[model samples]
Target: MFKYLKNDIPASIVVFFVALPLCLGIALASDAPPLSGLIAGIIGGIVVGFFSGSRLGVSGPAAGLAAIVAAAIGTLGSFELFLSAVVLAGAIQIFFGVIRMGIIGYFFPNSVIKGMLSGIGIIIILKQIPHFFGYDSEPEGADSFIEKSGETTLSALAHITDNITLGSMIIGIVGIVIILFWDNILSKKHAFFKILQGSLVAVVVGTILQVVFSSNEALKIESLHLVQVPAPEKLSNFIDYLSFPDFSQIFSKDVVLIAFTLALVASLETLLSVEATDKLDPEKNVTPTNRELFAQGFGNIASGLIGGLPITQVIVRSSANIQSNAKSKLSAIIHGFLLLISVLTIPMLLNHIPKSVLAAILILVGYKLAKPSLFKKMFSLGWTQFVPFIVTILVIVFKDLLWGISIGLVIGIIVILVKSYQNSMFMKISEIDAGKTTKLVLAEEVTFLNKATIQKELFNLHENSSLELDIRKTRYLDYDVVEIIEDFLIQARNKNIHVHLLSERGNVDNPESFIEFLKLDKIKTNETN
Candidate 1:
């Protein structure tokens, strides 16, 4: 773990900076105490990080679950009751992991996965627009297009002109410039620059600018526009911030329903985030999905026991970790440690950080995830891949992550069925002396989905024609397809069409039961009829 300290430490610092505002924002979005987000972040980073097989994924209170959390808190009558649900949710997630249900992540198409990341990137950038321009009406990590502030993603931009703060905007602009310069020029020139990290530098500069503008009322950023780290005032007083779940309510029906919902959402978000993070990792390391589910389960349980919001592997922070060049799980753990230490020790200083600065940093992160090149690359892969990829991004930007992914999955399935229908078999025609011959070659691993297409071809074969049916390359031909061929053979003899069956064993002249024939081992044949 210490082997890549140089890389991991620097990356962890960058992730720490990225996660700071996110923790507070997501909590606010969920209508929970800001400290709850911090607590979840701590557990996600430390507990989940330690147990997770993913080297780069960062977990925390995700914006994706903010709506459910907000509603759950309201429905459950008290935050304590909600905490009970969170604990139950964690137990449910653990059961899911033990059952190896993490395989659900594998069923998602590659196009849909790429679309998910790109869609998230677009959402991040869109949501951050108000923050970047110094409008703090919306939370930092909101996942939906329509925000709690009563504005859609694009509609909110209209209010920016009236609500934008000059001081925050100035710092945000400078931060973006600094990050761009540091990433493209300075870091490439010196090892020192790499150690400091562009985002960290931007955060420092933004804080300094906040202080510089303290004396100027015309340009001063309001407290609402800055990072709102909770200040406990004393070491002993910090204990009051921690609260345990009211386990008495854990068995209630409302609590049970909320717990199930939280478990399913959190588990899915974690699986998808880990998958996306593995893709973003420069080294292309694979994360164990089942292990990730287990890690998140424990993390959520710990968070709930200590009064934190529900947790998941947050892609925004995870992507930031990957972009920061994190080398191992150590980076995630270090970031968690830093969040705990900073929230407890130097929160006042952290509070001085302008939300706009973090917005600038996230804009960079979003750009990286949804670069124009990614669109072009997906497009070149053809409509089968690109259609689902593009659709996922659009839906995510307009609706939410879950809806967008669900839509993309449906589209991907349709594309698969279409492709299967088109390529189920190969057919050709030959004629000599007024006698016509048809050649039908079945595809490898033909399934029931191909039955209709194969049936259509056989139905079109003319009477008094010679037919050559080839299965030499076929493997695992579906029973449905075999029945179609068997029916066609019976029709051919009555239709007076001579047939030559081809397989590994040899040629057969319209041979008997296809069911019994298929019971034989797959054989190769070259003999002619």
Candidate 2:
């Protein structure tokens, strides 16, 4: 891994810039101390990165889990109790890994996965809009439609005009321009531009602009609009920020329930991110799913012990790492060290950075995830794929992440059932000298659901016509469908219709009894066996 330091170091710097604000934002959204988010980021990067099978996945405090963390903390009645739950969650994840349960991730449909990424992208964009214009009333990482501030996403945007700050707006605009220039123009002109990430440049320029406007009352940005780092006067005071889990709460029923809930959600999110990051990896490296669970389990355990929020493999930072051309896990590890060093030594400098600048950086990430081309691509795949994809995006934008995914999965399953019902059998009708000859072909697997359609076709058959019942392609025929065919053959004789049965055993002309024929065929098959 150290062999790629030239690539890893630069990528780590970019990821560090990308992760810093996210750590604080997620912590704030969880209603935990901002330091807890930072702690989780450090452990996720350093501890989890050391053990993870993924070459490029970055782990941290996930925005997707913020609402759960907030609610659990409230219900548990103390942050320490919540920390205990997080530790138990980690243990549960380890159990999942040991039992080789990582295969569950593969069961999610592709449409749902794509929908998830796009939904998260749109959510990031919508949530960042207010921050871009200097409105910071809502927490930075809240992704729900109904915010803690009692304002809907659209209503928050509507109130942006009233809360706009001139300094923040100016810096925000400049930051975006700098980022656009760096990405579209400068990066294309020189390889050096790639090393100097657009996000880092935007943050620096925004910081300088903040200093420039500090003296002018009309143009000054408020403290609320800047990054808030807990500045300790001494090293001892810094240690005081860390909180440990209360082990006494381990047996509490509520705590145990929350722990299982966290384990399930965190495992799912981690697995999905693992799949996504593998797709984005330039080298197409396949991460070991069970090993990833082990990494996350221990990472969360360590984080909770240190009074940090629960940890998971986050797609946003992982995508950022891939886009930044990260070559190995070294980049992730280095970024964690950077987070630790900066928070311990240079938090005041970090505090000088404006939230609008970070918002500008995330807006670019959001646009990349929810590009217009992706929507058109999904639509072209047909309704079966597009319906679930679009619904996932809309629900994630209007509701929350987990709910949106669940709803999309249900829709996708429904689409599959509908298609199965329609394609259960293939029928063809041709005119003959005697009458119309109808050929009915059963699918590979015929179920009871096809009984109604088969019954309708049989009843509509012309009298004195020839009917061919083809079961050559069928492997498993349901009892209900078989009975339907048997009943149809009986009725066909009364109507003067000629019935022919086609099977692997060849043609049978006017069998005495369909059921007797099936019984004879089964006996012959058993003898062959």
> Best candidate, TM-score-wise?
2
> lDDT of each model, Cα atoms only?
0.81, 0.83
Listed per candidate, the RMSD to the true structure in angstroms reads: 5.1, 4.0
* Candidate 2 residue-wise lDDT, 294-366, digit = tens: 9999999999998889999998789888888889999999999999998999889978888788778767767
Any runs in candidate 2 off by more than 4 Å, and if so which?
A: 1-14, 25-33, 63-85, 136-151, 244-265, 279-283, 315-328, 510-529
Worst 10 residues of 2 by lDDT: 136-145
- Give per-model TM-scores: 0.82, 0.84
Model 1 earns a TM-score of 0.82
* Top model number, lDDT: 2
Task: For candidate 1, write residues 165-274 as lDDT tens digits.
Answer: 88988988999999999989997898667555677788889999999998999888888788776688788988776877898878988899889878977887788888
Q: Worst ten-residue run, lDDT, model 1?
A: 520-529
